[model samples]
Target: MKITGLMVYYYFVCHKKLWYHLKNLNLENESENVGIGKLLDETTYSKENKHISIDNVINIDFIKRWEILHDIKKSKSIEEAGIWQMKYYIYYLEKKGILIKKGMIDYPLLKQRKEVELSDDDRKIIEQVLVEIEEIGKKEKAPDNINSKICKKCAFYEFCYC
Candidate 1:
């Protein structure tokens, strides 16, 4: 299976989300929050020069001559999940023997940029995380829904909590 950057993002955010997304069971299309994020993603990236390879493996949100992969986040707070997602992009590109020197996570809301680089050890860890995500998806039972402060802001809050 081709692991796209979005899958990696979902995996980092919520395992169940990745599972549902991979299985084409997502039901959050009606969420305005989700739509807003998608809109921001599209607007931030160049429409003509953008190149997407291997489904979601290489999503060049905005690429300049320097070959930098930029991911724009609309969230006010930076989270580990975003870092993991960026790392996964690096890992996937490196696994394919692509030349991805580094990536930048642009938090538009915070007006900050986080640089992401993958070391040899980081690749190993990302591979392990992917395996774990796949295993969780294959489980006979889904994990129990646990509400948290983050859940209040989740696009699937209504589907999972309501």
Candidate 2:
């Protein structure tokens, strides 16, 4: 299966969310926070040189120098989801044998850019994660909802909690 960076990201955030999304069940409208954040990300990265492509492999936010993939984010914290998202892009590019030197997570809110280098080990780990994600997606039920402080602000709170 062709996995996009977003899928990897969602899986990292909540496997149930990824399952819901892949199964054509989404609750994006239940939370305007997610929509607003998406808008801001698009607006912030909407540059003339930015190349947005939604292919079977992944939805590329921007291709720097036609080599590096840039994933622009607007989150306060650099979560595992964000890191895996960048790695997913790097994996796709590497699997395609493209000259993708690395990937970057551009946090406009923090004015910080984290560069991710894909080493051989990193690639292997990403592949393993992908396999696990795919297996999780095939399950019949969603994962248990473990309440956390982060869930208070989560876009999927209403669906998973209330």
Q: Which candidate is the best by TM-score?
A: 2
Best by lDDT: 2
Residue-by-residue lDDT tens digits, candidate 2, 1-162: 777777888887777778877787877766777787778766886663664664666777788786788877777453678888877787777667776787887888888888877778877888898898888778888888867676776666777887
* Model 1 per-residue lDDT tens digits across residues 67-140: 56777788844367777777887676666677777888887656688888878888888888878877776776
Off by over 4 Å in 2: none
What global local distance difference test value does model 2 have?
Answer: 0.76
Candidate 2 local lDDT, residue 37: 70
Candidate 1 deviant stretches above 4 angstroms: 45-48, 76-78
